[model samples]
Target: MTAFGISAFGAYVPRLRLDRAIIADAHRWAMPGLRSAAKGSRAFANWDEDAITMAVEAARDALADRDLSKVAALRLASTSLPFADLQNAAIVARAIDAPHQIASSDVAGSQRAGTSALLQALKGTQAELVIGSDHPSAKPASVQELTF
Candidate 1:
């Protein structure tokens, strides 16, 4: 018999949202439609916030009742990592105080990075803490950016 379980899950949405009208006004674009008009309230990470910070906050919340010593691995997924060479997941693991021996990895470059990490976790390979987040950028007045 085998049992695979979700040890924890957490999310952190930013407090501030940039309205769609602001984007439209900034780009001098005419209002598109009701859906497009409402698309503007996209969340924004604070000046002090970054992928690592958001991951740490979510990890803290997810692992609040669990012992990090038991977290055999940590996986972070983000498209807005602060550095290209540095491993962002390692930073998050350290921030959350995971055991020194635990494995850590990062998945980046796309919005689906988090989903990919989750797939790995479900395989019961090594990851125990998988964190996925994105602060994806879009051109002002672009519909894609507005929705995200």
Candidate 2:
């Protein structure tokens, strides 16, 4: 039987970080509960960075010192995709200069979007590049803002 498995992997976290304390302090006056969760910081993307850009960087990191021509498929997962109607994965593939013949797609909608894509890739019979990236949108002073 043929074998399919992950040979390499890479991840990218933005340089900017938003301290949970900052988030808590902003809302603690109204929601003192936030103070309990304000221990660590979360990655904050820059104005120029988005799901697509981060995915590209991670893919590049994984593909570093390797041949891009061998990549057979690309899958990008996120809850904060820049475009709702565009094929985001194609953009990522193009950004990485991945070959034109490879398959590419975007996955989103559910919180498990990334996990689902990863599971599918692992079960499939082709060499796939799966990336899970998110920049969730949360309302100010809301629980999501402090936790997400």
Candidate 3:
């Protein structure tokens, strides 16, 4: 199904980028190991940029200048979904103005979630919108601070 490929793409990154050296400098004293991963900058989500919101931004980009009527599903893959009880894919589908009948699901927990969702969708006939978004957070001065 080579013809069954992506026709459009969209993306969004936060305007705020955190230099990795800032993390290395601030925490190297306690966690010197961080220096190894502190060369590039990382996109730091703003207070308003949650996984759902970012996914919607991407959906907006992907759906722009295209016909979404053929889309049968919205698959959201993430390590950190915003709501524990709510379906994030549904939230994104709604944000994109997808038909209420559109299928929605979450591929989460594992690093291969996106691949898994794509493999599954490839078995179907209709186009599927797969989105990957993350907003990992940590407490101040913690290992996660440097890691994230």
Candidate 4:
């Protein structure tokens, strides 16, 4: 049988960008060699923008050319889920007006959770929509946080 393919894809980078100078100044003491290039810019989530909103934007783009009713399942992968216990995938499904019976769930914790969710969706029987996003934090002067 033929395997599934991506119908569409979308990415949303927040409008606000924190200058490298500010970051470098704040972390100059902590990170000796923290330069602008070393510490790339950061995207700031707007007041109303959360994981759910970002996921909705991505899902909307992914469903652009497809029928919402055809989406039977939605898998959301995120390490920065706004709510600890709530199902963010359901919120994304509702936002996109997907079928009422569509299966929805969240995969979180590790960065690898994205791959896990994708693998699970691909192995499943239903037509699936998988969305992954991350907003990981690091120490103020940590290189990992600055690079991303």
Highest-TM-score candidate: 2
Q: Is candidate 2 or candidate 4 better by lDDT?
A: 2
Candidate 3 accuracy as lDDT? 0.84
Taking the tens digit of each residue's C-alpha lDDT, what string does model 4 give over 1-148? 8557665778877788887767778778877677755545678777888888888887777677788776778999998988887788888888888889999989998878889999998787768999996665577776665666
- What TM-score does structure 1 among the candidates reach? 0.84
lDDT of 3 by residue, 1-148 (tens): 4457676778978778898889878887787877877877877888888989989998898788777788889999888898989999999898889999999999999978878887888888788898988787788656576556
Alpha-carbon deviation at 129 in model 3, angstroms: 0.9
lDDT values, one for every candidate: 0.78, 0.87, 0.84, 0.80
The better candidate by TM-score, 3 or 4, is 4
**Backbone clash total, candidate 1:** 1
* TM-scores, each model vs. reference: 0.84, 0.89, 0.85, 0.86
Report model 3's TM-score to 2 decimal places: 0.85
After superposition, candidate 1 runs with Cα above 4 Å error: 29-35, 125-127
* Model 1, span 1-148: residue lDDT tens: 4457675688888888888767766665454543446543778888888878888998888888787776788889988888798988888888888889988899887778988988888888444899986766666556765676
Residue 142 displacement in candidate 2 (angstroms): 3.0
Best lDDT among the predictions, by candidate number: 2
**If the candidates were sorted by their TM-score against the true structure, best first, what order would they fall in?**
2, 4, 3, 1
Q: Residue 63's C-alpha lDDT in candidate 3?
A: 84
